[model samples]
Structure formats: C-alpha cells, structure tokens
Target: MKLYSGIDLHSTNSYLAIIDGKGKRIFHEKLPNDITTIVQRLELFAGTLQGVGQHRGCDREKA
Candidate 1:
C-alpha cells in the first residue's frame, strides 16, 4: 500500500487529500488555514498508512 498527501492552502479554508498507489482516494478532508495543522494531519495520516513506498501530489494550491 502506498500513500500520498496533498494540501491545498486556501485563504478561506484549506483542503487535504490522501491517495493510494493506484490513485485511489483514502481521505479527503477540510482543514484550517494553517501550516502546523496540515503537517500534523499529514504526519498522523502517514503513521496510519505505513509501509507505503512513495508519496505524491497530483495538484497543489499555494497558500
């Protein structure tokens, strides 16, 4: 199982997406507009999805 993280830091509200090796979405969530929160979420999700070979970003939006 492979996991990837994508964080869209928008002005109003940021969005996060987690994708698997075969391009399947596991988690798509809306988070606060902050870097710390995003990192924390990513780390937590990363820990949950261990043994993943690689992480990738499909599309990204600058905060």
Candidate 2:
C-alpha cells in the first residue's frame, strides 16, 4: 500500500500523520521536534512511503 506523510511543525513539538492511498489514516502522533526521532519514525514506513511534506508557520503574535 502506498503511504504519504505530513508534519505540522512547531517550536517544541510536531504532529506527524501518515495515510494510505485511499486517505485512511494509518498512524498519527505528536513527537518532539528532533530530526532523529522523526527520521526514525519515517524510516519505519520507508518501503511504502511515497513522499513527505511539512508545514511550519509563525504565531500571529510572533509574526
């Protein structure tokens, strides 16, 4: 099954989500904002993952 991932990145943590081609969520979690942790998690699905995307934005107050 082909998989896709999206990450909502913040200052201290990030929300990771993976979905199948039919748009069913297979995995979702909140993880620390560390590259190693993220990479390791993604590696689990490397065989089937098609791509990964991330979104980072500033807070209204900070912007």
Candidate 3:
C-alpha cells in the first residue's frame, strides 16, 4: 500500500497527515517543530510512503 504525507509547518508547531493510496486518512496530528519527533512519528510509514510534501506559512510583513 502506497502512502503519502503532507506537512503544514508553522513557527512553533506543525501539522502532519498521512493518507493511503485510496485517499483514506490513516493518521493526523499536530506536533511541535521538532525534527526528531516528526521523524519518529513518520517512521512507521517509511517503507510505504511515496513522498512527503511540506507547506510553510508565510508571515512576511507588508512593506
């Protein structure tokens, strides 16, 4: 079963989501901005994950 993940990154926290090939949400959670924790959580799907896509929040100030 192929899996895919998407991450919404923020300054203090991030949202992680994993979905199966059929578009069924398998896991979802909000985690801190820690690489170790994120990697640990995603390790379970390492073998089946097709790719991980990340979207970072843009907090740029208007000039």
Candidate 4:
C-alpha cells in the first residue's frame, strides 16, 4: 500500500496530514516548526510513506 502526505507550513506551527492512495485519511496533527519534531511525527508513518505534497504559504510544490 502506498501512502501520501501533505504539509501546510506556517510561521510557528505546521499541519501534517497523511492519507492512503484511496484518499482515506490516516493521520493528522499540528506540530511545531522544528525539524526533529516533524521527523518524529513522520516516523509514525515510516516505511509506508511514499511521497510528500507540501503547500507552504502560497507556493505549491512537491517535496
């Protein structure tokens, strides 16, 4: 199974969302703007995570 993630980054916090290929939401959380914290949160999804679709402010891109 393939999983996808979307991250909405902000000044002090960020919104992270994960979903399966069928668009079923798997995880959602608000996290601090720290790499370690974000990494820890993402670790929960680990090996199954395939790609990331990030929307930072007005810029839309894949990361």
Using TM-score, give the best candidate's number: 3
lDDT of 2 by residue, 1-63 (tens): 999999999999999999999999999999999999999999999899999999999778755
Q: Write one digit per residue (lDDT tens) for candidate 3, span 10-52.
A: 9899999999989999999999999999999999898999999
Best by lDDT: 2
Q: What is the lDDT of candidate 3?
A: 0.96
Show model 3 residue runs off by greater than 4 Å: none
Q: Lowest-scoring 10 consecutive residues by lDDT in candidate 4?
A: 51-60
For model 4, residues 24-50, the per-residue Cα lDDT tens digits are 999999999998998898888889999
lDDT tens digits, residues 1-63, model 1? 667766666565777888887889888889877768777778877555644332333567789
TM match of model 3 to true structure: 0.90
Model 3 worst lDDT run, 10 consecutive residues: 41-50
Would you estimate the TM-scores of all the predictions?
A: 0.63, 0.89, 0.90, 0.84
**Model 4, C-alpha of 53: deviation from truth (Å):** 1.8
| Cα lDDT, model 2, residue 13 | 100
lDDT of 4: 0.91
lDDT of model number 2: 0.96
